[model samples]
Target: MADKQDKSQTKPTSLQATIAGGFAGLLCIAPLDVVKINMQLQTNRLEGLKWAKRGIVHQTKGIYKEFGARGFWRGNASAQWLYLFYGGSQFFAYDQIKRALAKTDLSSESKHFISGAVAGTFATVTTYPFDILRTRFAAQSKDRVYTSVLDGFQKMAKAEGFRGLYTGLAPSIVSILPQAGLMFVGYEALAPVFKELNLPFGAGDFLAGAVASGAAKTAVFPLDLIRKRLQVQGPARSKLAYGAIPEYKRNMFAAGRAILQNEGPRGLYRGLVIGVLKAAPTASLYFWFNARALEILVQNEIFA
Candidate 1:
């Protein structure tokens, strides 16, 4: 194990590692992504139950049947543009920002939290349009909605004005700040305890990520639900309506209020199950790959 670790500790720059992490993450999480979007796009409780009845296995099979095995990657192209730059910038920003704040005398936890949030916000805003397009394509039926990502952008712009491309900016940015911030803080803060108890850092990261994603996800799931719902808004798929959820289609707060009033608190967490299942691993590998990559960079004095 030690020899393997030593040998593996010479990969690439931190920027490269972050990019690789994003690409690798998209692969690991794509199926879960399909499941997650299907779950999120459920406009009502009954619609959600339809998915529950269908099950992950069946839905996955349906995806394959619809667009073939590659259907699982329906949004891969747009996702690449989003995740690649988002991932690289997020990590790089976190490191640079944290370093900049090193002399500030804030608590270590506070610094970590702030760094992660800033990084997340930076990444999210820059590549946000790709995010909207990715979700739209992911939620699309085999009908091949919007043709391509660029096509989707063009259609959205023509339909809803330029603002069409950024359906969930406000809620996403707000949610990401706390979500990413606390997640990183939790993961970093847990390191010493894990080391004291002799746990592997990677294992600790995976567990911490689960806890972080679960907590953050639950808190902001309504916002996330809003984001997903908003992303798939303007282009009404002529083929599928899921349900007549016209009450909350206009804006975030109204949508949130409608869900809480109609579906109660549980409405916000429509896809909590698959979401966390996807999120935990996503965050875990994000940190694990980053740690390994940074180790290599440091060893090579590239990060020195």
Candidate 2:
């Protein structure tokens, strides 16, 4: 049974599975992403956890009222690029690298963790600019910036050179390395219990992934918030009153401190609830579809 399980696991983490995961993640995560960006950028409240007041329902309604149904999908263009690349590349690296390392003397857990971190960093570094653009499109409300994806890229290049697209990349890499390592390693490790239960259609794998990813996402939520804030700092700072510190997000440590001082401890947790809700389902669907897609591909001898 253990050997069978190992074979199944090896088969499922394929390029086909990676592509399916990307599509599934995009569908599940795009709407919640917009809401999360909005909540994170909320600055009107003078006290504890302003996001506590603006629940998902409230944010959804406001976005609908202001931008209509399309509002829910504001940054989908960049999100599509981001999700496709991020989702596919992450699993691809994790799958291939781990398989290659299986010949070595490394323990399984170390292999899983290392592969996940490597894949995540490669994917993130390769496609990070798209994420910045997606966050920018999702975070802003009025006086629109960057009419389109091309325009966003052009603006970033013109304003801050190629580096403009990578505003918060350092902190993001720092945050994501551990988060990705934890999420994938934990999910892969826990997934077999579901197989033992014989959950239909790999439902148990989905559940395991959700639980693992939820935990990882929570642990890294503050870093995620800081990354988002840094991504949008340019526009926020640019519009600031004259003499205002136009680069508040220049330093992740300082930005974190500012959030603590201004918005209190809960400020670091902005959009955390929504992030968890979004992450659980998204991660579940991601793993589930990746497995299912690989199963199909294997059954057809596509990669055999």
Candidate 3:
């Protein structure tokens, strides 16, 4: 029975299973992200929860009226690539880092937090462009102004120069550290408690992951807002609108100052509610699926 149990545990822990679960979770929240971005970029009188609620209503109305509910998934195709690279790399790096840290005497919480931060930072660096692209796609309307990701990239490059690809990189990187640290730390702290209580891993993982994601996202939401504003704002509208992109224009503080002056501190946290809404489901699904996948892999004798 011990041998059989070991083989069963091994079945769900394969690397591929974990990756697939991550991707699936990301895909699940693509529509919510689209709605969230639309709310963020609204220029009319609507603002905050009022704006977000209205936006969701408008989007739902439009989808029902026009595309028959399928419109909500407008950017899903591009999002798949975003998820594949960003989600896969994040989990892959996170798992690897955790494994390495497990060899040390550090507390599980410490290892999990540090490993998550490192993994998030590394994944962000590698896949920031795809993230930018995903946002662009999500922010588009059914009218199809940009056409495709390549077109958006080309237009951004031509309009703003090569630097456009990394418009919001600074705040994005800063936000990742705390957000990811809290997430993993929370997950690690809760996992054992769940096990002790003899609950299913999926339920425990989702609840733990959701709480962790919400906390982390809330903590760093201001920075995330700044990053999104920078990424989505046009070059013609930014302080960098000097007709020529400068090599020394990579200062996040300066950019933040400009944003504050132009849009106020409240602008720094635009769409926070939507962000939390999107993140909760995304993170919950990821941990739930990933835990289940890991269980399956462990059971299959794939990663014992």
Candidate 4:
């Protein structure tokens, strides 16, 4: 009876821990995400560290000049919902896919990759419009803004039509495949190493998760560039802009060439440093918390 009570108590504690970890992780990286998006949208002619340093400096100056330190987190309210839907869905889908794959004869790596891809695809398909709004809100200047998430959504829909909400669906979906696949593969591969080194489960999970996120982001960095451009720019500038000339069909390829021509090969990886900075800690914390939470829940039979 004592053992049963202990078990029952364990699950809730674990679940609480997991939820705590995930939210903590999200808060940690929110500022970094702001930095990353700013960097990606900068049109200045700086390069390498000069470009990076300028972006950071400019962002800091803008934040201080506008909303002080708080200005940097401008879209955070809407972002909370964005992350909740996107992050929650992705994590949930990942677990579900992984569990289903566990019954198969596939290798752990194969399972992880497939699970990640499926999770990404599922999450994107379900919550893409919110994603578009989040980007718009994040990319907005302090002077020009949407009053709220619903305001942004309604405005975009009214102005651009229903399809505006899915402006960058093609590159966004394609980008998810490799990004998610690499993230899971990297996480699964590195987890054992940390375990072998005798680190605690939470610490090991975070470290592995960070590495996986970095790897995944690096792999799909180019796709992200394309997607962001399409999302931020209106129909005329996007690759999705279709017409009698089939101009939109060629816009994607043309955009790739323009990036290379104007910004050089390195332009394809704009904001990569910020991406790594953000992804590593975010993923690490998310997985660490998630695993710990699940273990606790299962032990208490909350998940059984």
RMSD of 4: 5.5
The reply for model 2, stretches above 4 Å from the true place, is: 1-25, 44-53, 235-246
Return the clash pairs for model 1, or none.
Answer: none
Report the CA-based lDDT of candidate 1 relative to the real structure.
Answer: 0.72
Query: Deviation in angstroms for 142 in model 4?
Result: 2.8
lDDT of 3 by residue, 97-135 (tens): 877887899987789888899988988887777777666
lDDT winner = 2
Assess every candidate by TM-score: 0.82, 0.87, 0.80, 0.81
Model 3, runs deviating above 4 Å = 8-25, 43-71, 157-162, 196-201, 234-251, 302-304
Cα error of candidate 2 at position 13, Å = 8.4
lDDT of each prediction vs. the true structure?
0.72, 0.77, 0.68, 0.68
RMSD of each: 4.2, 4.0, 4.9, 5.5
Q: Give the TM-score of candidate 4.
A: 0.81
Q: Could you give me the TM-score of model 1 versus the true structure?
A: 0.82
Cα TM-score of candidate 3: 0.80
Q: Tens digit of lDDT per residue, candidate 4, span 1-304?
A: 8886676555333234435434543544667777776666544332322323455666557545645677567567767776666666776677678778879999988999998898888878878887776666556654554678788777778877888888778888888988888888888899888878788545888889888888888888887876766666654232111111112232556666767777678877778888788888888877786676666656656635
Error of 3 at 47 (Å): 9.9
**Lowest summed lDDT window (length 10), candidate 1:** 238-247
